[model samples]
Structure formats: C-alpha cells, structure tokens
Target: MRILILGTGGMANQHAKHFAAIEGVTLAGGVDVDPARVEAFNQTHGIERGFGSLDAALAWGEFDAIANVTPDSIHHPTTMAALNAGKHVFCEKPLATDYAKAMEMTETAERLGLINMVNLTYRNVAQLQKAREIVQSGQVGTVKHFEASYLQSWLVSKAWGDWRTESQWLWRLSKKHGSNGVLGDIGVHILDFAAYGAGSDFSKVFCRLETFSKAENNKIGEYDLDANDSFAMTAQLENGALGVIHATRWATGHFNELRLRIYGEKGSVEIQHRHDWSKLLTCLGDDIETGTWTEVAVDPVPTNYMRFVEAVRSGQNLEPSFRHATNIQKVLDLATVTDRDRSEHKV
Candidate 1:
C-alpha cells in the first residue's frame, strides 16, 4: 500500500515511521504549508516530491490510502479531499473539531464506497480487545460500573502559560475551533475508551467542568478564552452500565495516567497503558471475595495501520465505522451545551 501522509505535525512523523516499518506500506512523501517542513521531510526520507498543497500531493502521489494526521480543525477537509480522490483514509481521532463535519466526511466516504478507519489506537491494543471478549463471554456476567481517567501534568506548572503562550494554533486551547477544551482534547479519548471497554454504544453523557487555571489561546493573547482545564463526566452505557470519566491537563506528577476499569456481576476488567501495550488485570469472581485481580500477560496487537491496509486490500469495512467518530464528537458537543460563555465557574 502506498500511503501518503497529511501534515508535518509530530503525530504525522510518528505515522510515517510506523507505516514505513510495516511490511506492505510505502511512506510516499508528505505535504505541509510550511516550505521548510516540506523540504525537510523529503530530505530526511530521501523522497523526491513534496507538494505545496494537499491537492498537488494528491495529484502527484499514487496513494492507495492516506494517513490523515492533520490537526482536528482541518481533519474533515483533508480527509474529505483524500476520499474524494478515491483513496481510503485512516485518520487520527476526534475525527473533526465537532460532530457535524465528522458526519459529513463519513457520509461522503460511504457514498463513494471508500473504507475509512478512525485511528482510535487503543482499540488496536491486543489486551483491551481480549478484555472485551472476557466481558462478553460471560466470564464477567453483566457490566455494572466503569471508571476511567487520563491525567496529565503539563498544566500544573508555573509556566504552562508562559511556555504555551506562543503556541496557540494548537488544536487544544481554543473553544472557537470546537467544543470545551480539555474535554475536546483528552476527555474525548477518556470517554470513548470507556465506551469501547463496555463494548457498548455510547448513549448519553452529562458533564461537569472546571477551569482551575486560565490561559490565552491566541499568540496575540488578546482574547479571553473559554476552554476546559479539567472535566468530569458521568454517563450511562447502552448495555445498562454506569460510567465515570475524569480527565485533566492540570494533574500534578502524572504525565498520562490512564486507568480503565469495568466491573461486572461475575468479574471485572482493568487495563492500563504502560507506554504501548495495555497491561490487563482481570478478576473473575467465584465465591465470597474469592477472585483476585491477576495480571494477564498478552502480546500487544500490531499497528492499526495494518488493519487499514487489510481493509483497503480485501475491500472490507473497518467495523465501528469512521462515522462513529462523529458520534463521539457529538458527546463532546452535548457536554459543552451549557458552557457557552466560559465565565461560569462550572458547567
């Protein structure tokens, strides 16, 4: 598969390396508005063409699929362009800034008979997949409670503002670009991860938000911003499961501490990401306090890109369609319905 990558962002670089390492993929050059980045990418990879625009690259490269790794704000337009050009797309998630654009992109893909893979990378983790099986197989009776969190320490600093003041085109800090901030940034993953663990369709969410700290979003810093610094939510799962998701950028000493736990009538499943592979601990309750959480050893799954290649090759759908990406964003949209002014202390 010849995979053309969009954007020259950090995530795009990571995608290039992962695809290049795979046996069947070719890292066909990259494109960005920055001429310096275009030349640098081509020079670094020993590739010939670095087009000035996405359209030019689409015209020049014979790409089977595109790795749409651009910022959330432009994910819709970029991925739509690729799909319109008759290429399958594997996009990184929060597929768009909001739900509507995401839906549009997904609709277009379906209309054109193109396979779309939203890169919810955690779904590709082997142990997490196995954990889902354990729950469904009646090793765990019926899921009852779920708790998940993704905590980061970057915002706990004295200079998180000073450090980021100049870095505002960042997709995370501006509400004008999308929904509430931290929720849009990390909480999207937190909630979706829980929904995925429950193996239940996301039903509804009621969110509570707090901004423990405030920062300007523009490099100009002229505008008072309304983005989330910390957020907590409780949601009802489609399968009669109860869930809570807590995510914040301001938690101290925790770079990215994520814990996903689901408790069921017969057992429980807990999975944590220790860098890459999900470390899974399962407890299948037997008698009174009989089951103990035991670490389950399992090799991690291969890259999500491989699944994209297989889908493109075999002419199959990557189930839990990319349209599901829009559904997740809708949850984010619903969470921010009360946060219109950003002056409110809580939503």
Candidate 2:
C-alpha cells in the first residue's frame, strides 16, 4: 500500500518511522507547508515525492492513503480532501477542531466506503487492552465509578518561553492554530481510553476549564491567550457509572503522567502509563482491601501500522475507527458546552 504523510512535525516523523518498519507499505513521501522541512524529510527518509502543498501532492502523487498528522484545526479539511480524492485516512485525535466538522468528515468517509481511523494511541497499549478485556469479562462487575487524569508540567508559568512570539507554544495558546487547549490535546485520549475500558459512551458531563498561563509575543498585551491550560469534568456513562476526568499542564514535578482507576462492585483496576513495570493492577473479591493488587501482564497490542495495512488489503473496517471516535467526540462536545453553559449537558 502506497501512503503519503501530511505534516513534517513530530507526530508525522513518528508515523513515518512506523511505516518504514511495516512490510507491504510504501512511504510515497510527505507534504508540509515548509518546503525545506519537506525536502529534508524526503532526503532523510530517502523518499522522492515530497510536496509543499496538499493539493499538488494529491494531484500528482500516487498513493492509496494519507496519514493526517497535522494540527487539530486542519484535520477536517485534510481528511475530507483525502477521502474525496479516493484515499483512506489515518488522522490524529479529536478528529476535527469542532464536533460538527468531525461528523461531516466521518459521514463522507462512510459514504465513500473508505476506512477512516483515529490515532488514539492508548488503544494500542497492552495495559489498556487488558483493561478492556477485564471490564467486558465482568471482572470489574459493573463499574460504579472511575477517575482519570493526564498531567504534564511543561505548561507551567515558570517554564514559559522567554518571549511569546518566539515561543513554540504560541499556536497551542492561540485559537487560530488549535482548539480545546489541553482538553483537545491530551484530554481526548483520556476520554477515548475511559470509554474503551468501560465499554460505554458518556451520556452526560459537567466541565470546568482553566487557563493559568497567558501567552504573549515579544510585547505584552499583544495577543489574547484564549486556550485552556487545565480542565476538570464529571461525566456519567450510559451504564450509569460516574467518573471524573482531569487534565492539566500545570502539575509540577510530573513530566507525563496518565493514570486511570476504575471501581466496581466486585473489584477495581488501575492503569498507569508512567510506571515502567506493572502498568496494570487489579484487586477483586471479598478480600479486596486486605489483598494486594496483582499485576496484569502486558501483552503488546497490534500496531496501528499493521492494522491499517491489513484493513486496507482486506477492505475491512478497523476498531477505533471514525465511527467509534465520533462517540468520544460527542463526549468532548458536551464537555465543551457544559463548561460554557455551566449546566448538566447531555451527550
């Protein structure tokens, strides 16, 4: 399968690395707004068809699919164009900056009978797969409550760049480049993973967003800092389970910590991404309090590269597909409105 990748940013580079290692897949080349980066990326990867424009590449580049690794704001346009041009798309998360656009993109792909998958990377984690199995097997015994938090200290005021204009964080802080701030950036993963583990969609939500650090160019009071830096929300599942999801870039001393705990009548399970070993732990039965939580083995899940290639070859849809992602998007949309409207929002 021939594939063209959009964006030469970090995620694009990561996708390229995976594509290189997968058999039966060819990296057709990549496209980026920066011509130099595109040229350098092609040369570094030994690819021959890099282009600076998506339109130019879609017109002349012969490829079966596209890896939409661009920013959140561009996902809708890029995926729609690729699907319209008869190319399957593997897009980054929060499918689109807005839920309406996400619906349109997914509908278009469905109408075309094309495969559309979102890179909710946590789905491919071994621990999460086990968590899903545990929950579905009744091991958790009807989850009653759950809490998930994804924290990073990189966005703290003390860590801010010397100047906003020279700061690489400007785009994220500005609505012109991205949306939903931390909520869309890393919060979507938490929502997707929680839903994946619970095997149910969120039915209601109440959210609060915070922006502790303001962004500025070289001069103060030049640009408005509108994006959120932290968010906390309480959500209820269709199964009537209640949970809270909190995400922040201001957690000091935490580099990248994503922790989730699900409690049920029979037992409970915890998934920790920061821990190097014993990432999945569970305790159950009457002796739950006295008994120790045993480690669940981490059996690696299939890589997205493998899944995408096989799905393309077999003409089969893959899990974490756009349809599944739309459910998560509904949760996010509700959370946004709940924060804005300050009322219990139904999904």
The most accurate candidate by lDDT is 2
lDDT by residue for model 2 over 167-210, one digit each (tens)? 35556665655767888888899888787887788888999988
Across 1-347, the per-residue lDDT of candidate 1 in tens digits comes to 88887887667767877788888778787888889987887677665667778999887857788888777777888888898899888888778877788889989999999999887866766777878888878888889889999887775564334435545333366665553578877777777678877788666667778764454333235433556778877777788888788888777877666789999888899989745345889887653187677888886666677777888889998755687777888888777763453422211
After superposition, candidate 1 runs with Cα above 4 Å error? 157-162, 165-171, 176-180, 215-225, 338-347
Runs in model 2 deviating more than 4 A are 157-168, 215-223, 275-278, 289-291
lDDT of each model, Cα atoms only?
Answer: 0.76, 0.83
Task: Report the CA-based lDDT of candidate 1 relative to the real structure.
Answer: 0.76
Clashing pairs for model 2 are 165-217
